[model samples]
Structures are given as C-alpha cells and as structure tokens.
Target: MLKSSLNIKVDRRDAKLVMAHFYVAFIALLVGGLAGLLQVLVRSGKFELPAGIGYYQILTVHGVVLGLVLTTFFIMGFQLAAVSKTAGTFTNKQRTIGWIGFWIMTIGTVAAAVMILLNEASVLYTFYAPLQAHFVFYLGLTLVVVGSWAVGTTIILKYAEWRRANPGQPSPLLTFMALVNTMMWTVATIGVAATVLIQLLPWSLGLVETVNVGVSRTLFWYFGHPLVYFWLLPAYMAWYVMIPKIIGGKIFSDSLARMSFILFLLFSIPVGFHHQLLEPGIDPAWKFLQVVLTFLVVIPSLMTAFSLFATFESYGRSQGATGLFGWLKKLPWKDARFTVPFIGMLAFIPAGAGGIVNASHQMNQVVHNTVWVTGHFHLTVATAVVLTFFGVSFWLVPHLTGRKLTKKMNKLALIQGYLWAIGMTFMSGAMHAAGLLGAPRRSSFSEYGGAAQAAEWIPYQIAQAVGGSILFIAIILMLYIFVNLAFFAPKGEEEFPVGEAANQTEKAPMVFENWKLWLGITVLLILFAYTIPFIDLIKNAPPGAQGYKLW
Candidate 1:
C-alpha cells in the first residue's frame, strides 16, 4: 500500500522555506506562552501587572497567537515537509507560492498582534460579534485565513499533479493525508471567511451600523470545531504515518487509515453547532442534529486508537512481550520523537472523553462558559496537538538543518513532554473541579470581592497558577531545544520516516481516493445542518448588537 522509501530528500531551498514557517511558529509559542503565564497569575489573584497592562488584552494575545497563528504556521510547515517527503520535490513555482502564503500570513499576524497589544482588539480569538475589534484586526485575521487557503491550494495542486502523472497508483499515505487535510481546511474556512469578510469587517469599519451576534457566533463555530479537526489531523498524520516507523513497526492497516481520514472529511464540518448547544437563536432541533453529527465524528478517532494500538502491539509481540499491557513497557520510552506523540495519544483519552461530555445537551448546560470547557480544550489543543507538534519538531528541525539530534537535546525534549503532562494534570484537573463549582472562564478576575461562590474557586485558581508556572518553564526548555538544534548541533542528514503498510502487497480501496464524492457529501451535510438555521438567525434576529470596547 505504501513504500518505505520514496527517493525523497529535503533540498536546501525547501528546507529554508519550511524553516521559515517553523521559526515564525516558535516565536508565537514563546510570546503566547508568556501571556498564558500572566493570565494564570492575574486570574489566580497571586500577582498584578502595571496599570496599563490589562488581563483581557493579554488573554486575547495568548489565545490568538497560540490558537490561530502557531497552529496554522506549524501545520503548514509540517504539511509541506510531509508532501515534499512523500510525493516528490516541489516545483519552483510551488515553493514560491508557499513562501508568498507564509509572508501574507506573517504580515497579517503582525497587524493583528499589534492591535491586540495596543488593546484595540481584546475580543479574544473567537472575537464574537458585538464586541467588535478595529477594522484592521478583522482584515488582518482575514488575510491570515486567506493566506492559509493559498498554502492549502498549493498542496492540493501538487497532489493533483502527482495523481495526473501516476495514474492508478495509491498516493503516498503522508501525501494523501496532507491532501485530505488541505481539502478539509478549504471547506472549514468558508464559514470563517464569511464571518470576517462579510460580517465583522463591514460592521467594524462602520459600513454597517450593527451586526447580529447570533449569526456571527454560528458562523464562527461553523469554522471553529472543524478548525479543531484541522489542528488534530496533522497530529494524526504523524501518528498513522510517522509514529509506527519511529517505534520500529509498520502501519497497522492502510485501508483503515484511509477510511478514518475520509470520514473526517465527511463528518467534521457539519457538527460545529455542537459548540453552540448552549447559545441561543439557533433552534434546538438544529442543535440536536449537530450533536448527533458531532458524535458521528468520534468514529474516526476510535478507529485511529484501535489501529495505533494494534501497530504497537504487533511491535511489542515481535520483541517477545507477553500479556496485554506489557507491550507498553517494551515500547520506546526514551525516544523523544515517539514518546511525545505517544503522550499526546494518552492525553487524548481524557480530552476525547471530555469532548463527549461537552457535546451532550444536558451535560453542556452544566459546564457551559465555565473553566471546564477551557480545561477540556487545553488537554486537547494545548496538550495533545501542541505537544505532538513539539515532538515532531525534535527531529524535523534537525533534519531540515542538516544537523544531528544530540542525545542531550533528545533528553531535554522528553523531559519537556513530561513536565507539560504533569503541569496540565494539575491545571486542567483543577479547572474542571472549579468549573463544576460555578467558576467562570474568560474572566480577568473571578474574585468578585470574596463572594461565597467565587471563594470556592480560589484554591483551584491557585493550583492553575502553579501549574501554569511549570508549563511556562517547559516551553522555555522547548525553545532551547529547537534553537540549539537548528543553530548549534553537529551537521548530519536525518531521514524522514515513511512507514509501509504491514502487508506491503495490500492497497487502499479505491473508494478512499474518490475525494470528489467525499467532498460533495461534506458540503451537503453542512447545508442540511446549517442552511435553514442560518436563514432563521438572520431573518428572526433581534435588534443588532452594537460593539463595546469592554477592556
């Protein structure tokens, strides 16, 4: 199904372009991490900043940089590497287009970061309507998104070119995964594009007097949940295509792998309304429909878990391991590249469980707008996705730089992953506990002058602050690892791992490659799920809400 070697090499020009993307992503991680620490400190009532530095301003920076900027840049860089490694060399035209996309996104990030830092756009990453930002902020973010579209377009074009040249052959699994994600992202961004370009930008620029908050939120979530899948699929790509080879095993099932990726394309988009289960204006019937769709999306994740463990178990048995859990001990525990993603998988167990909780209609009411939701996403995006990115960076940076990954740097990376997992346990666990006691999320300060309900949250807040400090330290270590490898390590070429299917003669079913069918189904689901609800939102909307500069 997949070949172990594709005669791929990371050429100098491609390496530089990919590194450009990663460099920007790391800078975001550093700045965003600092802001996260500040948030924890201030919200815990354990520290105060200068009068001019507001908490919400810092929070906005944290969310936007980490959530939007870091993920986009990292995923772009990763996909480029994946496609380049698996498919073939990129043409000069494709490389040029990629760089153009990178610059556009960087410029937009700078513009938006400037606005957030100046406190002109403290609306947070969601940037829900009626809490309007400056027109520049909206325009800047729109460019960021549009820029990603350009990147995705280039990748798809590359894939299309490959398919044309090599008719009837299965695409490399890594390339296939990249193409699927690019397609998913192209669809996902439609809603956000509408939110920013049609609605928010016009409203913020005063081209419109007011905007409907309900409609804006719905549009945002339309992009938002699928945005989560966008973050996750790259990690899954690494898991399915890279992790098995890293741990001395082959992919468990090429057919199952393709099936999961296809399912994501089919089910990931229409389920955004599950995020709006607690919001108003959308009918309950529509919300229920989304909830069901959201659960349907879970099928791929469960399949993924099964395929991965099967790969590990096969490897473990090959090494003479006995009994059920004994295979875990036989697996690589010291390798940074493998352990980081493995930890991410472990974290996902809890995170996915919490997601199930969030999607439940009755359960959502209990935790809506609370720190519980915040904790759940942290375990997911921050821990599972971000940590996996960090893990991959261990070898990726060194590989592209023509440097050897030193033993010391590998150890540092493993330690960083451990620290992150430990700190999150304290932070996220406390957050979930406090949320059940009625603690709010997104509040700069929850003290409420010692109100009894707020008093109950103090200890958990303090735990969060402590956990945050440790996590910040972990980020610092991660930065050191990347910088040292990129600049200071001994020169050596490292191979990009591309695993073969366990049975090399077996091919993925042709249906998995029929992308047009999958995409059409995706669009139909989105329309069926959202079309009437969106019309109702706009037609029955209350008086439009005016912008408020709350900070």
Candidate 2:
C-alpha cells in the first residue's frame, strides 16, 4: 500500500491547477505583509501615508488580503492536491470543473482587491453593515464564495467516485478529511451568502433604505466563527495525517482522528453566539446554550492533542528513548517541515486558552472590543494556521513542481519559522498587554486630547511596529524559498507523505462513511442553536441604519 501510494503522483494537469492557487497565495502574502507593516508603523505614531491614503484602507487590505484571499486559495489548492494524490488523479471533467472554479475565484479576488485599492471598500474584512462598501465589493465577495462552492463541488464529486470504486472499504484518510472540511465549509458559507445576497447587496445598491444591524451581524458571525474552523481543519489534517509520515512515525489511530473531525463539524457551527456575547437583544439563555456548545468544541481539540502526544511518545519509545521528558528530545528538531508546524502546535496552546476566555461571557466583558481579541486571532490564524501552511509549502511546492527541497532551502525555512515566532511574541504579546491596560482595537494612533490612559499603550504600539517589521522580513524569506523550490531546486521526486495507522488489523468503522447521518446531525445542531436567535433578531430588530461610506 505504501509503495503504491508513493508511486501515484498528482497528474501534470492537476499540478497546474494547484500551482495557480499558490501563485496567487504568495502574491497576496507580499501585498498583505507590506500593508501590515505599514499599519503597525502608523499605529506607533511614527509614520504617515504619503498619498492621502486612509489608515483603515490599508487595514482593510491587510485583513482581506491575508485573512480571506491567502487562506482560501492555499487551502483549496492543497486539498485538491491531497485528493488527487490519495483518491486518484481527477478525471478530465473534474479537472475542468476545478479550473473553472479557479478562474471565477481569481476574477472575484481581483475585483474585490481593486475596489479596496481604489478606496471604495474600506469596510474592513468583516464588511459589517452600516459601514457599507461599494456594490461591486459585495458582488465580488459573493462571487468568491460562490466560486469556492464550485471548487468544493469538484472535491465532492471526486470523493463520490472513489467510494463507488472502492465499495465497503474506507476512503483514503486525506481524501476523507478533505471531504469533511469541504462539506463543513459549504454548510458554513450559506450564512455569508444569505447576508450578502439578501441583505448587504440590496442595501449597498440603494434598493433598500434600511438594514438591520443585528441580523446582519448575527448572520456574519454565524459564518465568521466557523470560518476560523474552516482555516484550521486543513492544518489539523496536516497534523493528524501528514505529520506522522514526515516524522517516520505511524498515525496513532484512524478511528480517533475521524471521530475528532466529526466532533469539530458538530460543534463548530452552532457556537457563533460566543462572538456576540457583548451584543444586545439576544436572550441570555440562548447565549448560554451556545456557549455550552462552544465549550464542546474543546473536547475534540483535546482529543487531537492527546493523540499527538501518544503518537510522539510511541515513536520515541520505539527508538529506545527513555525518561518522561526524553521523548521530546527524540523529535526531529532539525527537520524544517516538522519543526515549523510543531511551532504552530505550540502556538495553539495559548491561542486555545485565549479562545476560552473570549467565549466566556464574564471574561469576555473584560477584554471585549480590545486589542486582546486582535492578539488572540493573530496567534490562532496567523501563527498557528499560517505557519502550518508555510510548513506544508516547504515540501508541497517542490513535490508539485517535480523538484526536491534542497538543504539550503530547508535551512532558510527554519529561519523563516523562528523569525515568525519571535515577531509574533513581540507583537501579539504587546497587544494582549495593552488590551489589558485598556487599548481599543480597530483604531488609529491618537492622543485622544491628551488622555492619560492612551499614553500607556504607545510603548506597546512601538513594540508591535518592531515585530511587524520582523514578520515582513520573514515573509520575504518565505517567498524566496517558494521561488527556489518551484523553479531552482534539483529535479527529483519529493514524497507526499501520508501515514499509515499504527495498527493495521484495526479498521476504521464503516459507519464513519455515512455522510447522511453526519450531515443530518450537523444541520440539526445548527438549527437548534440558531433558529430562535435568528428569528428574534429579525422579528424585534431595530429600524435599520442607512449605509455609510466612512472612508
């Protein structure tokens, strides 16, 4: 099985499709990273825009380009490659669908990006109502979401084909994981689609005089929180399925991994109210119920952590390592692919802790609307998820390009990861500290008419600026490494690692393949958590506010 898996390469046509996504993702990194650096500089009170550009405009660029564009493109490309390698290369029809999806997404991204650059859509990445953007901006984002659905269709069709061919046997682990994430994403995107098509679009086009802020926000958060999980599950796939193979170890248990993913899908969507804990109009009972559901997500996260510890310890012991802490030393610290993503794993510890604090109503009150929330997501998405994607690129780009990751490139990759860690420690750490001291998020530098409290945050802002500069340097290094791997590395095959289970005799239960059961449960949970709150939002909502182009 291992030999056969290794021998099955992604088809040449499929590689072109994957690389198209990578090219766009890397370009976004450069643009977004520069914008981030500028943001920090301005907030530090040491710089000004040269061309009458608004600070929020660049902030929108930083958030939308990195948060939405880079993540979605890279994930779609990676999942496509994983499915092709594991399930079998795509049929010509499937590949054509993928290309079509790719072009639509690219066109949409270009439209949205141009609007932002023209200062027409300065509503930030959230695009919250009342602070409206151009009609094209809304249309562009809608197209992006629709395009992703099209891309996800290809993955679904391919998985169905695999199941049809295999009959009774479990689908490939990577392919199964891709399918779960794709389905979850499809379900989650419906909220955003509804908000754009039904609410924001009409309002922005002047067809509607008023828009309900509560319903719009409620719908956005419904899509927003799970959007975090959407970015995360792909990284989890690397952790559970690919990391073991990279480290010369076996997956701890196939059933445990699948069950954990199932748990994430079940718990992730029904818990968006946690983001609106500070908002009014929602009954406390509903908020509390959603908070409980949110806490349920921690169960699968812990399961993943436990499984990883077991995988590492088991692998270490097999190599004759001893002592409670000795297994740590046995890890492949020298390998960039292992070390980079391991750093991401470490970042998630604090990120998860911060998330718990944010979800708790009482604790959230203390940090609500503060830079601490900004710091929390930076650690979660930027450090944990983005770093893991970079780690994947170190090998993935080479594999798709028919090249090997050279020694020089690997060393540079290590430097890039560590630089990122150091930079984030400074930036996110300072943001958290200043937030505790009452620094507001989503605001530009200001003395606030000589307010005493604002003075306290300036030093931290300087530290953030320093850190952002460092992160930009790391981004440049990463881009260089990407270029080398794609065009300059030695021509050879690079393994696309897919680990086997530690116990071959134990098969994953056939019930896991029952998507009807899983999807039904997922829908039920979402409705149970959302239906009443949504109705309340619409039924008792205040007279809607007219759109404002604040920028």
List the global CA lDDT of all models: 0.89, 0.90
- Tell me how candidate 2 scores on lDDT: 0.90
List pairs with backbone clashes in candidate 1. Answer: none
Q: Could you say which candidate leads in lDDT?
A: 2
Model 2, span 436-518: residue lDDT tens: 98888888875342678888888999999999999999999999999999999999999888899999998889899999999
In model 1, the runs with Cα more than 4 Å from the true position are: 1-5, 544-551
Clashing residue pairs in all predictions, respectively, total: 0, 0
Itemize residue pairs with steric clashes in candidate 2.
none
- The TM-score, computed over Cα atoms with residue i paired to residue i, of candidate 1 is 0.97
Report the Cα lDDT for candidate 1.
0.89
